[model samples]
Target: MKSILTKPSSRIYGATRQAPGSKSISNRILLLSSLTPTKTQLKDLLNSEDTNIMINATYAFGARVQRSQPEWSIHKLTLLTSKHSELFLGNSGTSARSLSAMLSCYQGNYFLYGLQRIHERPLQDMLFSLRTIGTNIKHLFRPSCLPLFIRPLATVKDSIRVLLDGSTSSQYITALLMVLPMYKRKLGKGITLLIHSIVTSKPYVTMTLLLLERLGMIVHRYGWKLFSTCIIANRYTGPSFCIEMDISSASYYLILGLVNRSNLKLLSICLYNVQGDFFLVCILKRMGCSILVSRSDVSIYKQARKLLPLRIACHSIPDVSMVLLIVTLITACSISLSGIRSWRLKETDRLLAMTMELRKLGVVVECGIDFISAYSLPTSHLNKDSTININTYGDHRIAMCFAVISSQGVNVRIMNHQCINKTFPSFYYVFNSLAG
Candidate 1:
């Protein structure tokens, strides 16, 4: 599918929107809910390919899942019953890593795999940590990638020590944290995790701990390198909860308001939300956007002042880097983005993809191992063609970021526009509605 966004009108009024539920929070809550024995009522759940993969994986693990639009009722089993199962998680890294950790504690024969891209994603760090805890898991094809065969222990050891390579993905650490509480329950002792390198996406790990703490789980951290969690409670008392709107999704509209000098309000969002992408608001504010935060809403309006060039360390908030790069493009300001080496391991090589795509629009981008420097270029240097076709490489972020270029009255045709279904299926609809 190809999506064409005509240059929108300069001024947008009376634009108020709410994004879908946070995909990160939704999937984390889904996995946590499946560990409980009672029924969990989750409201404002994200209905997307990634979250759906998590839901299906939960069901495949013998949990009962029922959904009704923005709500879902999950009845979890005391223990997973399917001893022999094969799970195809598509390209969801969260599902593959989280479920791999959960399945490692059960006494069963399980196989986990995904699409070609998923196989290319890193899993060795997670697999190696699980192995330290006596999980009988092996890579079926390659050394570090997926198609893993898992045989969990019939009885867990007294204490397990895990040494993780923190440079790759924080999801590996979160996967262990999510399942370790159960392991602690079975062993009557806590699990210790040691980080051998500086962890990326640390805010994501913090979000995981926050959710676990909300569910009455105990987590202890020593500096940024070490973490330990013990099981204080064996059974989870399932509770009814509502998820916040996705801040990452809200970012596009934020950018829309900033560049277009329009007023925009995002409903069902809070200033104290757990998402690391919430930092985007502060970034925009620093870039000279006027933002107001209320209890349940955030309003952004364009400022008359110039947007100052920024040098930001985005290790904890890598997901927003794509949109931020677009921000630099529209502002025609030199910006330095650092601490994003893990961007290479995402749905695509985002660094490379962004560099390639931005050059097509006559932007100068220099990419390093873990940094990106975007030099200011006049929009006049853009291709003289009526429309620029952007290849998305099946990455949802790539599709969404280029779509923002349309706000500058530059027509963009995003190839593989359907990739947005992975997270925000209504992205274009929302964009069109607000762009008017």
Candidate 2:
């Protein structure tokens, strides 16, 4: 495995950078744009493996995608030319789940498969829901896993209702929200999604609903258990859309600025409630970090070396939890995160990966079924210039979070550092440029 060893910089200075486009928003918008026949230009789309998977998936489905780096024009294909096709989604939960659901609603036989890790992730919830909605689907490999086949609609009903468990992942909810409107348009019937439990990653589902509204789909909600979209003549339509900068991606820098005591400005960030990860600012405030938020930027600086401890539920911000773990070491404050049972279903077992890596730093870490608690050791206990080897496990978040540990005067050798290409391809470039 190729590894990159990052050492602590002797000096930290003020710097400004714009994070990559929001992966959540970018992928959501990409799938939504393809569902409609109207030609759309997506501005500031994230150029990463996952978004590229969505782009390729759409193109395979007949959308004419013309790429111009950050900007891509997509002309949605109006009809299906082939009856059978196979697609590969490389461990991208958003791409695999959402795209599979979208394909199920269409008239085709889709043999969806992906890398080994993608197969290991949970898909039973999504598969069960599709079967409930009268879609013909079969698990071609291990039962309730990926390497599945979705046949043409076996039956069309007057009212399509699928009972889905939201406790695992919200992409299931997002997938249904994006596809149901198209189902309504095609079947001349309303769609209802009955969420069986409290939705995990509720904020991500909110992101999807917001985008659905932008595409002219009005989804009526009955608390968290139910979402209904009344049948309408209007089809999905968005001529042009702009994706926001990735708030989750900016989280590494936010914690870095605090730990390194650097004056850093994150540009092109809109202080919006749409992305749950943007709540990191609130966490920073609780940590006693000096944070200034303007219209389009967030400036972070260290107020004090010692900081208050934190215990947060990570269900809404699972992707940010890895970075938050690093904060414990930098601040010498206890940080406990809960509601992260879904971590097991991600690219790798993040809960386990983080626990193992933290223990290597001599920090006391405890992990449970849905929680991880890290009690910090004093900064004096850390051996400065000591190199710690981090196995990235091919998970992007794991690699990026550990990279920031170098800011704390500890060197980190991150294996498979290129795992970041899954989301933030420019992570190391931006990280290196911020040092003086």
Candidate 3:
């Protein structure tokens, strides 16, 4: 699991096994549990690197959590003493933002820091919204970014509304909602927050709403763009919330089923999900893959297609870009993907990394300041290098994305094989197991 991958000269010829609970869902549920005042139990929560870091950070931030067997219990914080405590956010952005927003709403002096790159990442938009609402947050470096110092606002008058930039991260909006519930429930007055923007990655916001509703709270969404709701402070008994298997994580395997032309049976695939990433199924169908969605599962198989010149706007489904990008690579076809501009701010500079890494395979990629378009031609260049060593850039998506390149039978070496730990720690094994 730790070695650099060496791609074979022939087809990787295999099937794929899937990972469990979505990391995105895991982080959101963790935040929900922390905000809920009563004991809420979480079931099927991801125990992966990122979610685990979130779990530890949650307890560190003063949320009492207990894990036993298949259920985990959470006791919310009445008062998270915020006195100059330096909180390490690790590499989990959801944990960092959601937790930071929570701490800001609480009365305290807290220094917010994260994994080195996380501190380097910007949080200004969210920070400014928090500060505007009168929470204590200071940027040691810039105005709207991370490496923040949050000093408690003693006289912050309990309620405020702010705007969120849709082009940026939806996490900012999610962070606002996460804090809004608490301020409404515990603090003096309930806040009515109105967010106006062309929201992207609209599924994530849906995930937040869905989880909140499951916790027995109410919230409203106007289409996928506007969210307005009041979370009444209630005695929450954290009932067992089963985490959904990651559809995004299953994408690579779905692609494998098509690419390998294998005879593996598809079972229990979730297609009708409020999770926005489910659109991946539509995108695949467009590309001429044979996919059937049954009541029990979804199956994807290969077919002959007039592979269109795909110009996809991926801003709504950032996490699935890896598989899409690789699919473009296989077709030797031209693909222009947009709406993914914010992908630059992901765990890695996704735009630049995707372009540079694909170029190593002798494919031509042209990336604009905000978009990336690539085209590969039919060529006999599979074994020119015999082994392609690609850097993961510390982003898990990049690592898994390139793993597909090996399907063509080219020995691809991944610089940091462990990066997949962010969402799917057992990705390599699960993938290779299909080879058996």
True-structure RMSD, every candidate: 1.8, 1.6, 2.7
Instruction: For residues 200-309, write the lDDT of model 2, one tens digit per residue.
Output: 99889888888888777788889999998863335667668878888889998898777767799999886754889888888988888899998889999878757888
Q: Output the lDDT of residue 421, model 2.
A: 98
Q: What tens-digit string does per-residue lDDT give for candidate 1 at 291-378?
A: 9999999999879998899899998999986788887777797789999988899899989999999888877899999999897575
Give every collision pair in model 1: none
Query: Poorest 10 consecutive residues of model 3 by lDDT?
Result: 9-18
Give the poorly placed runs of model 1, Cα more than 4 Å off: 1-11, 154-158, 380-385
lDDT, residue 269, candidate 2: 85
Candidate 2 has which clashing residue pairs, if any?
none
> Tens-digit lDDT track for model 3 on 301-348?
777665667778887788786677786666676777888878788898
Stretches of candidate 2 off by over 4 Å are: 231-233
Clashes of each: 0, 0, 14
Model 2 residue 376 distance off true place after TM-score fit, in angstroms: 2.3
* lDDT order of candidates, top first: 1, 2, 3
What range of 10 consecutive residues in model 1 has the weakest lDDT sum?
A: 4-13
